[model samples]
Target: MSWSDRQSPIVAVATAPGRGAVGIVRVSGRGVAPLAQALTGRTLLPRVATYGPFLDADGQAIDHGLALYFPGPHSYTGEDVLELQGHGGPVVLQLLVARCLTAAAAPDAATGRPVLPGLRLAQPGEFTERAFLNDKIDLAQAEAIADLIDASTEAAARSATRSLGGAFSHEVNALRDGLIHLRMLVEATLDFPEEEIDFLEKANARGKLDGLQAALQGVMRQARQGALLREGLQVVLAGQPNAGKSSLLNALAGAELAIVTPIAGTTRDKVSETIQIEGVPLKVIDTAGLRADHETSDEVERIGMARSWEAIGQADAVLFLHDLSRMAEPAYAAADAEIAQRLGEALAGASTVIHVFNKADAVATEAVATHLAAPPAPAGQAVALSARTGEGLDSLRQRLLDMAGWQHQTEGLFMARQRHVQALGEAAEHLALAQAHAAQQDGALDLLAEELRLSHDALGRITGAFSADDLLGEIFSRFCIGK
Candidate 1:
């Protein structure tokens, strides 16, 4: 949006678009008091909820509601804000919004001009974006507002709340402060080339760099976990028909989410469930069995297999299940080998593949151990379990948590996005370069200073201290309207 568009007074239905106990129409911009007075037919006490009838252009009561006014530089958008809370029916809310527009456009008796010129409807996330722009909150906290709304688990919600409360931004600012101090020391020493190294040593620049790197690593680790919580892993199950793929999904989810049967090719489409392990959400997908295309003359089975491969290719992890009971059959073994080769080609090391040996109850203990000893696909982790008995499921859950890099600690953790993680990664890379420079016997003070600056800039991106307009637009655009 242009500067003028942002400057215009904006209004939106603040509550969700549905029937509820109450609904709200929120307006924010400079000089909104007149609009408030015009809407309510009376001057509203600042920050006070005064029950009154919202008036129309003809001075008729559109709806009876509570009118609240907040003066500029203190409200959510750092502008004068007016809120009208009424009944939650969608029709009434829209009527109130329409009244607001009409009232804003109507001419005033004093100057015979629109009461609130340039009043418009708010775009998605414009309110929160204004909060960020006004310094009421940082970019990270603004993102946390959406994260909190979209959080799927209790842990995720708590983490998002922490982030919205500025826990993550505080840590990032602390790191940036340290980097600034170290950069000051290094840049100041660059003026005296002869004593640059001695000055850095005396100022403990090397020790400070080490400390920043350590702190960055700690933050990086937590950010990874937070990102995992935000964007959970996609795990796809693949194997030959009747290899217990559906049964395994049911077992992991602890519910019969997928229909399991002795018949082959029962699941012609993907059946997915999101299960949480140690607060980390894992979307487990059960796909149709992989078989020779010629073996299935049915077009639906062929299409299902194609989609299964598609899911596998896009998955964060693929569970290549093996039926221990069928491993002894020559045809089954050959088919498993072919599927493994295709899986290897399909994934191309882009995703991890876990070898799951199912139906252990139907196989001998020695046989299960032998297969587990050397899985068909030796690259990823292997597990032997019985889906029907729910045996060894804990081990699989732990494996997933390990793959997610979850340390099982949620306290004080702040929700983070992939961009935040990438920014931290970039900062860490620069910090590593700074360390390499400092380790040199005759370190290049200029190069070291440049690295420190780059790292600081990277950290600044997280809090929006150094952010592009496009990035800001992209981040806030995902938020719901009126946020």
Candidate 2:
């Protein structure tokens, strides 16, 4: 539809609210030029910023500022656009908006339509939505616009910029093309009994399936890493009493964020700190030490341990700490073996664990070397470090960054939300189902096609190509109104 024919012009403050050096009031759609002309008392040249007085109905200047115009199909929202850059006072900007609204609602002769009869202030992201509808950008790129706006870190911003540049859409489109080819092959095999090639019989069927799965998995991993970079990872420190868990927390954060003591169970609660390792955000938790005794009437201790277990279950990674120096200390020597056994069982099913041998500064020479040579825990994959002295922290930091799947040279990475991850996961699941269906004898072509279609549509929703109206509302509502 032509910009002029669809509704009327929409206006909004494109700048942040409140006091600032400048505030921009933006209007787009058929009435933009007419609105500007009415307020400025002159015609606007395309793409040019003109010094003008924004005037009201009585020709009284509301605000003196620069006015810029972008004619339809070439501007943001692919509509005729006008921008009034005025002083940032809230009251003054409101008056400026009133002046434009009044002027834009005037009648026009050429189209025999009211210049802005149906125009109203835009809802959040409406202008961007109009731009998408007008084919200014695809859905994925449109979402990237919001990502770019909300990006919290430099890496995230760069990734969003790349997605806006079409990196993400290109990958999805490439995968879709592959799915199409596979579907075509399946269809051909079903329809042509005498066809020279049998797709199912071809040894390459398995290979193709493997390749597709690998590609999807790789993309999923990268997307997940991107999501983590955007959202951060939650890590919980869990271990027996006096395992140096608090010390490790402080070490990782490079701050005295948690209290540390030689006494058993000094920390009867959870302490959390946000830290970044190589720019990868982490929510690090220092939890109460895990113990099995119930004789003591410490309800808070029980609650803390329960909360720690909960954190462990939810964590992306766990730091299961052990005090090497303490194992040799007479006070802890009697219980060392029991604690070690418990530690092994506690961390057995963890998604990932870094066995940390803390208090390296005081360990005996031979014992220290042997422990340092050994892994972080029973797994022998541990790092021996003095959390108090900050020794061996660089290695631990690198390991955390590696776990985050971040490379310093992040060229193609793009920030994604957990919602995007879930959608991609669903798409991947459907594709696997389709592959399995295709592999079956007398395979259900209809089922395979349906699954493939669902997969494609899921990918489309990531970019807004297949988004529901409500999803758009949810996404844009989170944005500042001025955005």
Q: What is the model-wide C-alpha lDDT for candidate 1?
A: 0.90
Candidate 1: give the clashing pairs: none
What is the alpha-carbon lDDT of model 2 when measured against the actual structure?
A: 0.76
Candidate 2 residues lying further than 4 Å off, grouped into runs, are: 1-9, 98-115, 184-214, 238-251, 254-273, 286-313, 328-351, 369-376, 405-409, 433-448
Q: Write the per-residue lDDT of candidate 1 for residues 194-214, one digit (tens) a residue.
A: 753585569887889899999
Clashes of each: 0, 7
TM-score of each: 0.96, 0.78
What TM-score would candidate 2 get against the native?
A: 0.78
Q: How does model 1 score by TM-score?
A: 0.96
Best by lDDT: 1
